[model samples]
Target: MSAFIPLSVPNFGEKEAARAAEAITSGWVSTSGARVGEFEQALADYVGMPRAVASNAGSSALHLAAMACGIRPGQEVIVPTLTFIAAVSPLTRYVGAEPVFIGCDDSWCIDPDAVEDFCANHCTLKEDGLYNNKTGAKVAALEVVHVFGNMADMPRLLDIARKYRLTLIEDATEALGTKYVSGPLSGKFAGTMGDVGCYSFNGNKIITTGAGGMLVSNHPDWAEHAKHLSTQAKSDMLQFFHDEVGYNYRMTNVQACLGLAQLERLEDFIATKIARYNQYKDALDGYHGLRILPFKTEAEGVRANHWFYSLYLGETDLDRDTVIAALQEQDIQTRPVWALIHEQADYPRNEAYHLEKAQDLRAHIVNLPCSTNLSEADCARVIDAVKALV
Candidate 1:
């Protein structure tokens, strides 16, 4: 039997071990340490944001961003359904805001055109905000995820936000190193483009800190307030005075130690990811109905981190589940894209607009093994196995 090629996993080694040891030896392994603030600064500088606040998890960062956006009860925030539920759930669950799900386009991200259409046809421009005619809820924000390291149409999305006065939040959990390569916003990283950008450091993500996240923004006050709220809204640290309800969402120094080491090698990891993606694309080229879904590089000028290598199975005759099971038999892990949020039992009452593309993508897209540590020979094995199955 061959070695098991698992899905994405953390790529850590000597540097990570050394840093974690240092954190432990220094006796500052918890939240009260210099490394945590230093890690936040490093992420802020890398993403070109003025400030960043580290959190215990990515979902907490999203929740903090929602609170910072002032997403009060009954308000609406536009989101894409074809992404990890963590990106949309915070708005509804944390801030009591409702989500208006949008569809994905060729970039496999929130379609800017659909968003514009929804705002124009289904909503009314009011005094302070855009109001949905059907639900009569104020459309307060637009949270777009950089799906699989592929950037959404930011130019068009930004224009729509400006016109509608919507607070723009970028759910960049899976795209820490991805940056726009061309046009006015070229060189800007994924989470830095919007009013507030959220990043994840999960085990399967491009970077890992065991489990952590960061919230960044151009506005200093927003970051400061988020930092304040994350620390339990402490008015006076010495006296233990609390002003408002807050969360204990700060990341530990131990996690930050791992994150700092991971950040140092982020560029190298991105290079590996791009090389593997190109190798897979070249190998799969002209192979019947199977096609590798591409990142939005040419159109959006994106320097993609290539988070996940997605196989578009729409044109293929094979059943998605059958292919997955076959791959499992070969000890290679493969999984389909996310189930649309609106279709979930919990969000049955939420509105999803122009969901054709998102629905189609959900049924056809299969994510392949794309860990930064994936070897060339292992990659080739995966490709050959898929080809044989097809």
Candidate 2:
């Protein structure tokens, strides 16, 4: 009997165990331990950001980022249709802003051209800021998600932001070590490129802290205020006084300890991800009409974390769901891309701009298993199973 391969799983060893045990024994297992601050500092340094605020989840970090950006009610934030709902939900649910969904380009990231088209064609630049003429709402910010670890077109997006005088927030939950290979932003990490960026450390991420997140920024005030907002807006050190509405979103010390251990091996995990993706690419070559999606390198020097390897099944006989079923029959786990956010029932009234590419992508992309600890033998089995089905 063959072992079932999972879609994604955490990679942990003695270091994780040791750090977590230390935090648990120290009686600082909740949110007040020293490990949390250390982990936050280490992440900020790694991403080249001046400050980082740890939170309970990526969604909470995003809400804090939105609050820091002053996303007010009746404002609009441009987001992509092909990302996790968590990436855009906080903008609307927490801050009372509306989401203006955009399409994705070849990188499976926000299409800068689409963004420009929407802003230039449908918006008016008033003295206050850019406003959507149709909805009569101020276009306050652009929430860009680094989908599946691929870098968005930051240069173009930055130019658009500058022109419109909009805030830029990065939902870099899946792109922790990804950086630009070549460009002005070369050597800069994904989360650091935006005005404010958020990351996730869920169990399935390249690094795991069980469940955690971090909000980062180059601006001192944004970072400081975001931290204040996350810890229930405590106004004083000795008292439980809160001056404003705040969230109990701080990360636990135990989670931070685990994160520290995972962070130590992030580079190695990224290497393994790249190697496994390459192996899958080679194995699937000319095997079927199937195509293993490549990391975005449209720009001269863009390096991706190669997080989740996906297959485009347009040329294959099987559709996305069929392929997933076939893989399951072989005891290999596979899943389709997230349903387009605009098409989701919750966002029925949300405006979507030219979602053709996103719709097409959602129907054809199948995420494959690429966990860091996935063994060569298990990978081979997965490939063989898929080859047989195709």
Give the TM-scores of the predictions, in the order they appear. 0.98, 0.98
Per-residue CA lDDT of candidate 2, range 118-181, in tens? 9999999999999998999999999889999988889999899899898999899999999987
Local distance difference test scores for all models: 0.91, 0.90
| Model 2 CA lDDT for position 312 | 83
List runs of model 1 lying over 4 Å from the truth: 298-300
Question: Residues 65-144, candidate 1, lDDT per residue (tens digit)?
Answer: 99876889999999999998899898776788899999999888999999999999999999989999999999999989
lDDT of 2: 0.90
Off by over 4 Å in 2: none
**After superposition on all CA atoms, what RMSD does each candidate show versus the true structure?**
1.0, 1.2
